[model samples]
Target: MYYSRKRQPDDLPQEVTAIWSCTNEECNGWMRDNFAFSAQPRCVQCNSLMEKGERKLSILENTSPNHSKKK
Candidate 1:
């Protein structure tokens, strides 16, 4: 039996999403804005300040009851 591990294009739906990107050039850390716990989030990896940005990313919903979304 041959099994392919690769994901097909239709498997993931992408959208231009709001995100927080690390201000530090050395850090490649980023996260979806909707999932961020704060208005201004810090990089989880480097603890550096983050800036608002957008990227073409796979659509994912945050279903955790405790997770709040504040604009």
Candidate 2:
């Protein structure tokens, strides 16, 4: 008997928005704007100031109770 499995892609909404990328060329790190704390967020990996840019990424869901809608 033989078995095989195929990798599946993530299920998320795609959109173009601001992003934070590490200034260090050696480190490859980034984050979405909506999830950032300030206008300019620093790279958590290398503690370097991140650069602002635009990119297409999956929509991150907001499941926090603090962000829940009123009834």
Candidate 3:
């Protein structure tokens, strides 16, 4: 007998966070908010402006050494 099922990774994350959505009419692009460095970000796919939005995605850790902090 042989197995036919694929095994899932053990490091799967369980959380949701904000993201940026592309405003392009014919493009489907989005990015994590934490990775953004500006108040308003442009879509990397079509260079269109992005809007704030929420999505249910796996948790991600931000490890940027030059991360800016707001008082």
Candidate 4:
């Protein structure tokens, strides 16, 4: 089986957004701040406590009508 090795254009708009990073060093769990519904979010992957941070991610509009503004 052969697969194309060409680098495809992934030019999506990027933004430095707020995020939650897991405090557990072994866990690599994180989430976009705007998408989080709670003042503090637990890692969905490891259920560990998370801290505030920033990351460069492809801009995404959180269109979930039920989402609440915590910050």
Count clashing residue pairs per candidate.
0, 0, 0, 0
Per-candidate Cα lDDT values, in order, are: 0.93, 0.78, 0.85, 0.87
Task: Rate residue 12 of model 3 by lDDT.
Answer: 68
Every candidate's CA RMSD: 2.1, 4.6, 3.7, 3.7
Question: Best by TM-score, which number?
Answer: 1
Worst 10 residues of 1 by lDDT: 62-71
Worst ten-residue run, lDDT, model 3? Answer: 5-14
lDDT of 2 by residue, 1-71 (tens): 99767534465568887789999999999987667777788899998999999998776665665553323
Residue 66's lDDT in candidate 2:
52
Per-residue lDDT of candidate 4, residues 1-71 (tens digit): 99987745476768899999999999998999988868889999899999999998888888788977655
Q: Which runs in model 2 stand beyond 4 Å of their true positions?
A: 1-11, 63-71
lDDT tens string, model 3, 1-71? 99766645555666778899999989999988888888899998999999999998877777898766443
Would you give me the overall lDDT of model 2?
0.78
Q: Which candidate's lDDT is highest?
A: 1
Better of 1 and 3 by TM-score: 1
Q: Quote model 1's TM-score.
A: 0.83
lDDT of 1 by residue, 1-71 (tens): 99999999788999999999999999999999999988889999999999999999999889989788665
